[model samples]
Target: MRWRIPLCLLPAALLLGAADEPQLVPDVSQREVEIQYSFTGADLLLFGAIVYPDGRKPDKPADIVVVLKGPEQSIVMREKQKVAGIWVNADTARFRSAPSFYAMASSRPIDKIVDERTAAIYELGVDKLQLSPSSLNDSAELSRFQEGLVDLRNRNGLFVERPGTVEITDGVLYRARLPLSARVIVGDYTAETFLVQNGRVVAAAVRDITVRKSGFEQFMASAAENWPFAYGLVAMALAVGMGWAAGAIARRI
Candidate 1:
């Protein structure tokens, strides 16, 4: 994962702006997730408070949007077309950077909360994800590939979008739940909260969450990564031994 400033801590330049800027205090339910053998899925609760300078809750309603993004990786999307009555790979597009997992929850519909420009800048929705290709391609072709990738990811539960899901309490504290599929990639994840007001982002926060294999899963992962050949050999040997044991038991029976 690339280095990025934590959203909870505002930069000096942004903090110097003016009064009335909403201050955010954000936190996640868990800072780390461990993937075990029986791991099914996980639900992460992101909660935060919006603090004002005067220490008074606002009368006006404020919108909140939370985004959870996993590690970024280069992905090769292939388009299959029928060739001589057989489906074959026809076109391939290599995306320079794409999130392995993405899920969002917002207080209201994104379009209603922020304008298109702000949405695009923040990459609010999965469709608005910035997936630049490694090579130059036709505009129409690139769009098709991009759409296909998003659709594919969404279908696989890697990309998710939920609007009007964030719950606000007393116009200050807000919370949202983000789900992670069992197949979620293991890496560093980011949780971002945006306070939108009048079609613009007023305050933002970012936090890091780690997803990693643990216990037996962790040992296997380490072995495979550090000693691939030995791991493969051991796995093959285990399979052969299991097969032999089963065969012997059957013969005795």
Candidate 2:
């Protein structure tokens, strides 16, 4: 009889313990790298608010400030017989500088997923060609390098200043802000993020985004969207115009 009571309790205990066991799924490949954006809109305005991680936007982004020498920047590529490969400006990090492409992205100190000490920059392609155009190399072989920097600039280099910064606490979780130049030429751009430790780079990620033009902005962006500091000035201008008109009517009265 005592054996029967213990046996009855054993079954209950087994059922209770089973609830804490981990799932023994056959495949684990379903969890892969993924990037998602919240708004499905095209044109990402220069000074507009950027929401990260679609479902979870942080209250404060641990970001970086990247200021570029827009007018002076150039992306060039060449094919050298010695290496027998196309050398892009130097190489393509996908998220860093490429011929005619400049881009930047930041991080949120949220999920313990990002390493903060590394340098992170954004990049995209502007123009590209094979080295068959420049007169510098008269040889037909030099023609390969012709599709170089000149062609990239001719496709329209952006005169932009993307100011951003990166910060992570305990070497994980991040947030950032990326601002494009109001004069940026619309195209497919790649945004990159990185993690570094003690001056050494460790991790890299690349994402593709489009800078489009549409909506009411096709005519002219409100002066505020065109320039960050100019927003205040635009408001002041409207105020001044109203004051002037009010004064003129009062004077006639």
Candidate 3:
């Protein structure tokens, strides 16, 4: 006698045979974000599901790390020193590729979940960011400049790190929330998810997000970019008009 498996069980059998490593399916709350005149900020939800081989959760729960990174730009970092009772630029360090915005969320403190090497490789923490220095060769100088840049951006709410923020459920689903600063520049961004188990990154996935200007802000940005001379004239006229109006009001008062 010959027996055949049921159709529903066929899929399970196939998965059991084909599945070896875990996989990540990730998504972001918003694919496109518009920055208008009243734009304050936004909270982005990064969620995903983890698919393990044979549809079985590992005995040891895995960890999740989510990173939201904005476009890269070349930046010059200036160090100011008091000279003759006035602060002036003393040294400058240029970075070839530095992230305009970067925020990271992890299930636990990065040091608790992964070693320094692993953290550095994946940039799990803000301090692990790899800002490629253009010219500086001295290790100590480069480190100082990098720290200064990170500190400046942190004060501006551009670089952020939140530990113990990612929530994992049933060892299969995970979610994290990251904030977008109002000062973020318009560009393409990426939300990356990593599944870490046994101190190794098992699977990773990414979702794209776009931040753009809209309405009056969009029009102004376009005008400034496409018609620089006209925009400059308009800006000067507005400045002068505002100044005159303020002076007139002060005189009348």
Q: Which prediction has the highest TM-score against the true structure?
A: 1
Q: Kindly give the number of clashing pairs for every candidate.
A: 1, 32, 0
**Per-residue accuracy of model 2 over 138-253 as CA lDDT, tens digit each:** 45434334334444433443322223334344332444443343445445555444442223333334444555555544324445576757777767898999999999999999
Q: Taking the tens digit of each residue's C-alpha lDDT, what string does model 3 give over 1-253?
A: 9999999999899877657889999999999999999999999999989998779898999999999999999999999999999999988999988999999999998888899999999988888888889978898999999999999999999999999999999999889999999999999999999889999988888899999999999999999999999999999999999999999999999
> Candidate 3 — worst ten consecutive residues by lDDT sum?
14-23
User: Which residue pairs clash within candidate 3?
Assistant: none
lDDT of each: 0.91, 0.37, 0.93
Identify the runs in model 2 with alpha carbons over 4 angstroms from their true place. 1-164, 216-253
**Candidate 1: Cα lDDT at 101:** 95
Query: How well is each residue in 1-253 modelled by candidate 1, as lDDT tens digits?
Result: 8977777667654666645688889999999999999999899999999987778765678899999999998999888999899999988999988999999999999988988888999999997889778864699988888888899888888898999999999899999998998879899999999998778898899999999999998998899999999999999999999999999999999
Prediction 3 global C-alpha lDDT? 0.93
TM-scores of the models, in the given order?
0.87, 0.30, 0.86
In model 1, what lDDT does residue 225 have? 95
lDDT for model 2: 0.37
- TM-score quality measure for candidate 3: 0.86
Off by over 4 Å in 1: 1-19, 57-59, 243-253
